[model samples]
Target: MTLPEKPASGAEQPTMAELAEGYASKAGLHRSSNGNIDVLKSAGGVQGIAESVLPGLVFLVAFTITRDLPVALIGSLATAAAFTIARLIQRRPLTQALAGVVGVGLSAWLANSTGKAEDFYVLGFFTNVAYILAMALSIAFRWPFAGLIFGFIRNEGLEWRKHPARMKAYKIGTWVIISVLVLRLVVQVPLYFMGEAGLAALATTRLLMGAPLYILGVWVAWLLTRPAPAPADPGTERS
Candidate 1:
């Protein structure tokens, strides 16, 4: 009796070996040093960092000097607007600048309308809470946000979830990110309740923890998901 032949590579469903090879290659591409740099670049690099922090810094300084809410709010909003305008003029991406403007505007409105300086940080605090909730849900569903992001970056769809090892790696990475967000809330929430001095503390906390902590989390996620180095080829092995 003639035995049945196995399907050709292109005609067959991907074997475990093929899946692993593809997954490893994609993960290596995304978890490289350059990929880490891309994370910072997406956050608007040096200029983006400045755009994010400067307006808040200006507000804090103005508030400290004048102790006048309206004056401080105006200073902050003006700085945000100027950054946005500059980005527009330079033909750079407006995402960071525009986000800064909206954030500062909402913050200013809240602080001014309520006559409570601490209210300025309310939006940010709640935004963190929302992120925590979303991340928690993703983890519970076994469709981690980190995995989704990795898949999106690789343009490889959701195939990573099919591999038990990769799925676990993504789950761990997502938890790491969730931990960072939770830590922010744990530290910042108490300060938000303290009124004026608390607002100052909150602002300082935000400046200190914001981008640095985020970058650290990204690095940690990359480390967790990075593929193991491939085994050396027998032909290329050193004697």
Candidate 2:
């Protein structure tokens, strides 16, 4: 009997560049047909904004009304779970919703362990510091995180590293992002120290400075580091 033909190999895995591009795309970075970065989409649109804000908002409202840490934690976690379940029912990607659930769960655990409502927000301070340090290191290493992100979004690949001007622009962009994280710590840390009395203010500022502020920072960075327009060909000029 003739030997059976070997099966074809599965599709090749994506290259690092392609993987980076995919990540940037999921991060909501996209250039419109008109060549403008879609800031609203990058901010994950309205549904995404609600996903990022609602859990904390629920916790704040619950605590404000009842002044009970356990009730507030339950409310927050429930809000996150509702979003996750809705995503599952709709057969949509679960990444953002699941992250929200995990975050809420962790915050709940911390606050429950400490018996302090403010401990719920303690995780967020560490998160901000981690991001700030990471971005700062990327800039110091001459591989600004902004370059890795925006470069892929703009399809510049790693070529931006060859040009000093491009490098300077990306470093600036990275600093802009770092600045946003720093501002969060600067404004929120004080409120966190006020303990339960500061919980309301802490939660309120966290909501205000969370996704909304980050979007603004990214928008500014995009504009600042945008590639310069190509020079017009002299031959194409009107006679």
Query: Which segments of model 2 are wrong by more than 4 Å?
Result: 1-21
Note the residue pairs that clash in candidate 2.
Answer: none
Q: Any idea how many clashes model 1 has?
A: 0
lDDT of 1 by residue, 130-185 (tens): 98899889989999988876655544468888888888888998899889988998
Cα displacement (angstroms), candidate 1, residue 103, comes to 1.0
Q: Find the candidate with the highest TM-score and give its number.
A: 2
Q: What TM-score should be assigned to candidate 1?
A: 0.81
Residue-by-residue lDDT tens digits, candidate 2, 141-236 = 999988988887777888999999999999999999899999999999999998888878899999999988998998888889998899998888
Off by over 4 Å in 1: 1-39, 152-157, 234-239
The CA lDDT at 183 in model 2 is 96
RMSD of 1: 6.8
What TM-score goes with each of the models? 0.81, 0.89
